[model samples]
Target: MKLYVNNNLLLDNITIAESLKIRLVGLLNKKSLNENEGLLLKNCSLIHCFFMKFTIEAVYLSKDMKVLYKETVKPWRIGKLVKNCTHVLELPEGMTTGIGIGDNIILEGEKNGKGQ
Candidate 1:
């Protein structure tokens, strides 16, 4: 799957971490994420980068795909919890440039092909 912001391709090869275990281990122990890859955590608002080796841009999204908050979280740091956020997108630093608060996001499925 891929993530698009205002019809602009944002992240490809998206890994949806909907399960508890998957969400718990999000981006942990990973060496790095490709420039076009990211992880989407369902039912998540806050994130910790305790075991991550790199920084990431975290985008908090409401259930309706509204961008509620965004921040560049460094390794060993904790992201802020945005009220009413039902999902969280974790991407490589600078990947979220130009995306701002209140921007509507779209989660494109594989049917559209990768990175579309």
Candidate 2:
């Protein structure tokens, strides 16, 4: 369940803890998240239900894959911009630090040859 950008490993199957109530309303494999493309959720929202062992670097996105919010969320922290968010991209912890909001993400990498 690792999130990747081309050959670059963004988040390696990081745990999505219960701290966030994330309802996977719509899902696509690697093809869904595009390089330089944005994610837009049409009919669903992601919820964070707080619990234990929740490991994720949450990257909040708008309908056009524009970065709306970001946080290196663990077990107890709250996810920002829960509302009005069209998509949530979870990267590895520290993968998105200092990356300003409203900016587009450029997914870069090659196929690392590692299989889940």
User: Best-fitting candidate, measured by TM-score?
Assistant: 1
Q: What is the lDDT, from 0 to 100, of the residue 25 in candidate 2?
A: 23
TM-score attained by model 2: 0.48
- Per residue, candidate 1 scores C-alpha lDDT tens digits across 1-116 of 87899888877788888767777778885899899888988878789999889999999999999999999999999999889999899999998887999999998885321221
Which pairs of residues collide in model 1? none
TM-score of 1: 0.90
Tens-place lDDT per residue, model 2, 1-116, is 34434344544433322222223322223322233322222322453425524345667766655666776666545566565677676543456654667776444334222222
Candidate 2: Cα lDDT at 108: 36
Q: Count backbone clashes in candidate 1.
A: 0
Q: RMSD in angstroms, all models?
A: 4.1, 9.4
